[model samples]
Target chain A: MMTSTDAGLPALIARMTGDEKHAAASESTLDVLWVLYDRVLDVTPDTVHDPRRDRFLLSKGHGPMAYYAVLAAKGFIAPEELDDWASVRSRLGQHPDRNRVPGVEISSGSLGHGLPLAVGTVYGLRAQGIGSKVFVLVGDAELDEGSNHEAIVLAARESMGQLTAVVIDNRSATRGWPGGIAQRFAIEGWATATVDGRDHEALYEAFTTPHPRRPLCVVAVVEPKSGQR
Target chain B: MDMRTTFLSTMEEALAVDPRLVLVLADISAGTGPVLAAQRRHPDRVLNVGIREQALIGVTGGLALTGMRPVAHTFPPFLVERPYEQIKLDLCHQGVGAVLVSSGASYDMAAAGRTHHSAADVALLDTVPGWTVHVPGHPEEARRLLLESLPGDGRVYLRLSSQANARAHLGAGFLTLRQGTRGVVLAVGPMLDRVLAATEGLDVTVLYAATIRPFDAAGLRAALGEVADVMLVEPYQAGTSAHHVGEALADVPHRLRSLGTQRDVEVRQYGEVTDHDFVHGLDVAGITAAARAFFR
Candidate 1:
């Protein structure tokens, strides 16, 4: 019952192994990345560097293979670049370097760092009166970084409508940190929507719609199956 | 020069010259009366991000990224500690030039207790890349440094004290207090007064380093010239400042010494004390005593 788009993902993941696969597996949240790249996002390989293009920042930057895979699939990068990943003098490393990689708006690997940068980018675009939207993907574990809470609170307070903070709450932080996923952002007055991450239709709807009153928080809850990785 | 007065004067001057120079404040603007008045005068430019420290810094970086020169004000410890990642990744890494006005340095917040004290900010922020750390000893220097940083590239941390007294004028590079220097004592921030007072009758040169991170090594060596002993006095940790001075004067036959508190006290008690008492508590006097012990 697998679709053609869904069938291509596992094969792409299969080609990557060892530490690369392990890293990519953590970004199983890429089901959303796939939806964004293939369907929702208004970006093209030719217009990757265009200022008018929508900006996407991978805040949870540890598992870069998923991003790399999506970029390669989108023709933004060559498939051959995957071989040189994490290699010496290679542009592809553990994290995405915007200078080395194309279509990356900001270089990020550190947790809780991207939201504020995204906020800044959105604010910049608003000042220039540019209609470009900014999308940032943050991991649930990054909620532990108080800066994220600070950013969410400010976004809501400022009513920054163009900023969309996508939280991949896979329940990973529960293994280590206190507090549940929703409670942290709810206190900030952000309009949050929790969705099954693997659902493509719901994600597409959540991403494209504009929230004029408040900052939108889409917490995609992904349940990892046993023996999946 | 008293930095508080200089900061207020320069801000007023900058506002007069260019109306675009926006002063953003957190919810704590009432504590900074003059700054709050400036905000009231230029209501369009002044923005309050409430008590959210991280958002305040991030918004400032965002505002600066869009060609607005934002002077974000906050308490020292929370300003650096709360949104440290934002300062590093969002501001520094992205090459945004925003002036961070930190009001509490060392024991400036002694009345507010240890939680408000920003003794470790200099040492912590100095390590971050593309950051210019400026601690003006007095107000005139504060004015010069603030005006200089306004139109410059990259991020700068302006550490201001609550004390409102003028001391000495700071020039470009290191200023040598005495000429015939057998030994040199380098001091940064408000502690220069103590170091200068300590070396009043002594045959030693006192080098007041206005800019700490991009330290003037050649100037420090040129000033120290054949001096046998080298000492660093700070209200924060000695590792960062002492190491920089040591590296700058490596060729010279000199030994480096540092004096500051290593850890915060465990108790949560708060009390009022003069700047001298606060410095003494951090062994600033003891460090000077040790320096004199070696030099004499």
Candidate 2:
């Protein structure tokens, strides 16, 4: 089993290469995942069940090689498990399952489930008076689903200060949102920011910026899915 | 009070006592008496998340994931059908549990048209596993079932309706109300009183079921005497539990008859709840005619 003492993100992700259809999907989330797990999130393998720990929900769960790699790099899972990710005997599947994988907050492959769940998680923590922060990662295309809009409206309206939605925009959406994706969240009363997805410092600064009483939306703009950054 | 009212009032009580409980809504009954007061008192605990049903269920699952036992309320179509994928993946697949309390059994909002009606709720839920379904016939029964479901973290769907029996049967499995020698008639939830009234002079055993998901096959088998003729009177779509009946009586030689709302045809014309019931052959006269034809 590969541990924290071994290979880095690129090598870890490359180990689980065969049969992965959406390499772009996994690649687009690489820096954001590394930044969140490595720098931002307060969770570790031991605090998976801790009520007060920050939550990271991967709403864009398709082509999860990068996510698995980051989890392995952060010591949430055994690095060796990535060797047989999609195998019949492996706990890891194409999409992540929270039950099988430690530190996964919600099991998602469906397009629009993550943001709504994150909003709820924020609401739950606020209700219990716990100040745990929640971060959800969604693809720009996944926002087309009406369910995400419902959550977008709600999270801002409720002023869920503890929630952060990081939209990984690879410019892959079918009918792209006019005036960009950040406006969609900004108009709905969310605090919005757009940053270079691949630049680690930009991603980190955008993530930690404070927006009290308002849910924050950080759009990590990456190269289009057709090109490499 | 109605079943909806009973559910709200009971939830209000639960919120006051349990710190782990949360109430999520989709503006369905947010402005009403108990809900309004509960929301005022427990602002954090009671949430009214606009009219978004998909988000309503997704949010419910999220709360459950945090170890909070959430009870989400809305109409049947919105609660059970609209965001079924969320129910499948978020709650069931996540291995977390919440109490899904839905009003409007079948066509409770008769004039609201087909969009509001959801006879396929239980049938659609049947497609997924690990759900305990309760079709409560009266407000008191709805209260009792909600109380029973709240203490534990399990996936429980409590179907509350405006159409109700005069009294409540608070037991699980099939409860035998009347005995006979000819055949067995199972009345599910709100269909109990009508089934009893329809089969008054006939020689048949009538069974009542409020909890239908974990279909009590053992109870049904014990209720059956020498005669293996069985008839099911359900309040939802026809033959919803026919498979359960078939599986329950797999060894016995039996003839099964199912009577409920029509699945193939859409009755667009809406006037009254009773009118819809009659159109669906769930009224006393319709059930009587169908029961007599099968039993005799």
Candidate 3:
């Protein structure tokens, strides 16, 4: 039986079914991905390769059913493709490869690859006189990768105004950050927002609010991975 | 000019002409003032990302995504090995390429210990597909190749060596300095002069190559002729060219021997480059002895 939520996401997610599916993983990112694809990002199907178009990099690319659902719903990718999400002929793999998947910015599966890549993307965009905003979505546990620390500190140091890091806090790390995820970004000079992960209005406001001069971090606190809210 | 100086100056020149070229430094290389000067002149173009080699690669991959060609600079261990995942995922897997210019090739800083050495760096990169590796024999070759790597979206590893050939081989596709019917000997990068010295009295053809990637199969095929005995001498690890050579001469029956740094022995002691080179059988005498034994 298909379960429908207030946002009609459960129907979209029902398209992907398998034994190894990260159900909790996809559910955590669904709302944030919807909010960004629906209201925040200036990217569309046509503007993907446009120089000035906004870039939305999915740094936390693990069991990316929610990302696929969001991309398909927004018309960036076809909905039927989600049926064969992990099949041999499916362009949609468990982890997203940007070359094969439309609207996907970087090919990411490794934990720490995204934030640093986003930092570089923002730098490149700024270098070209293209002021398009670059957004990266990372998991709270993903910050455990030392490479993310390198990028987080560097991104804050560079004063990358157009870069935004939306860290989904699901209490996934084994040994969590000392002062929580938002504090890490705050210590590094980013304008931060800690919000309820499932709330649509709060996410939209946090993402759209002016951080001005410094990069912004919206820590979307979600349910723990232990099936507890 | 030395290869390292030319590396800095060529970057400065390229940055001046190409607006799309982004220079990222890891602060592990010998010189930074020239590059930092370029950063000062064009604050947007050059970035010194501190000693973060992993972040260096991450930044380079990011720049490549935005249609900007990045020349990510540092030593081999730091530039290639430390951030290898960054290179593999962010650059190659993402279908974006950057100019990875690495100094202190192999044992260039032999006295600086194994941490500073990168003989296996090219071998590591060869593990990944679609990378063009160039080990320049001279500063002129380094300058030319570095300039060539900037425009294309292809991934390049421009390895600079402290020990250089007294004269440059300007020709392409393996310059044949001496021709013979006994066998053919291919020397890569800074190993050319020593290779030439090693094969002085031997009845074998000598070929000097600065560019190692897309590995000159046609040149090897044409030069092999009837007698197919071949020796590949590289400045990095031994047998690094074995894969390409075997592929190039797959049909022909040939005797091949590769000589370079020894992989088995760690040589835990530190000394001058010559000391390390002697220990690794990289000196001219060692090359000659190995060449004599292989041909016989």
Candidate 4:
């Protein structure tokens, strides 16, 4: 099994073929996934359903190859399943299906949906008196959805310190829209931070030590290489 | 009593009974009627997420996740249409226990014009899985359904109106107003009062569905039983309830008659009218009259 210490996600992604590679190459989200699988998310193949396992929700789920690849590498699924990605019977598809995938907590693909569900999961855990942390990785473009802003404001008011919202910013907010989501989140009273998307250490730090009294909003600034796809 | 007053008093009673109950409001504060007063009485439990529909649903999902039962309120149109994805993915997909209290159905927002009127909420919500759609025709049913949703795990959409004084017969599943030898009339939400008034002294049974999603199939079959004709009355589109009943009772040799607004975008015009006028304009009266002709 490919372990977390494997060098560079790009090299690993290059080895993939068919829909899996195509999806991974299209977006720069793989770097964030690498950090999640390699060092941050505290889950093993055997302990995926452990009650105390940290939950990760892919809010920006359009290109799911990054998630599939990380899961496959982490031995969550066999590597051969990546070839059937987006097929009629494939568990790996354009969007994440929580029921089909063991590690997935909620099915997500539509923009502005993951944050609220993540919030709900956090709330559910708290209600059951479960102290497990929830990490939701959302695309910067998803902030254009008014619901994301609504969730941000509410999370702050509730002081949902256990929930960490990481905004993966490839700087792809549609033209003319205000792109300063980090600033917006900070203004709303969340404990905000930013990091270079490709840096594993920075991503690890952000996920490991979330703010104790407020939700943590991390904007991972990234830029994909040209002709990568 | 105004339906709003009853709805609020019932909700406050429920809240007093359960510490987990929470009410989240959109921009419209005073407009939600008595529910607003309950929120005011319990400020810590009420969350106003401005006018954002999507965010309102998401935040409510968050609250539900944390062990709090969140009842989110918003304009019917915004709640059903604008934040639809949030409702579907966050609440239904995640299996969160969040109640969506939406005002404005048919003529509920007549003065606010077409933009505010939510004509397709029932039809839209019916398409979503695991979400119970409760279109309470009067105050009492609204109270009961709201109370029932408090301890449940799934999602609920309470389509309400500003008309507070509407009367409702209290019971669970389908309420039979009259027992007829022929097929029964299945009425949804507040339309129960209308069908009952229309069929007074006649030997026709009116089955009022409090929960639209699970839709009491055995209860419906038991009530309608070998009656060869079934008529459905609703404030939503014709196919909404009729289609589901037909699918569920495919083996029963019954002629299904549906009464509601036709599907036509051009016919969209907003105006001030009581529930009676809106139902009558949608040909509910004509359809009932036609059902009588078929019986003869």
Per-residue lDDT of B173-272 in model 3, one digit per residue for the tens? 7888898878999999998999889889888899888899979999988787458999999888899999999999899999999998888878676889
The native-contact fractions of the candidates, in order shown, are: 0.54, 0.78, 0.97, 0.71
- Give the CAPRI rating of model 4: acceptable
In candidate 4 the C-alpha lDDT for residue B278 amounts to 53
Q: Write the per-residue lDDT of candidate 1 for residues B134-203, one digit (tens) a residue.
A: 8877777778889988885568888887653246566777777666567788777676777766666677
Compute the DockQ of candidate 2. Answer: 0.81
Better of 1 and 2 by TM-score: 2
The TM-score obtained by model 1 is: 0.83
lDDT of each: 0.71, 0.91, 0.87, 0.72
Which candidate, 1 or 4, would have the higher TM-score against the true structure? 1
For model 2 the TM-score comes to 0.97
Predicted candidate 4 versus true structure: per-residue lDDT over A119-217, tens digit per residue? 666655665567777889888778887667667877887788878998887766664236477788888889888888777777778777758879999
**How would you encode candidate 4's per-residue C-alpha lDDT over B1-296 as one tens digit per residue?**
54556655677777666878877777765456555666667655655667777777887876765567888877788887877777777777766668888876666666666677667888888777877788777777788778888886678888887643256767777877678877778877756666666666556677887667777777778886456577777776666787777876799777877776565653455555554345444434665575676555
Model 3, span A1-229: residue lDDT tens: 1121544556667888644455788889988888888888999999888989899999999958888888888788888888877899999998999999878998888899899999999889888888898999999989889998889888889998899999999999888989888888899899999999888889989999988779999999999987543
DockQ of each: 0.40, 0.81, 0.90, 0.48
Displacement of the residue A1 alpha carbon in candidate 1, Å:
19
DockQ score for model 4, please? 0.48
Checking candidate 2 for backbone clashes, the offending pairs are: A2-A80
CA shift of A41, model 2, Å: 0.4
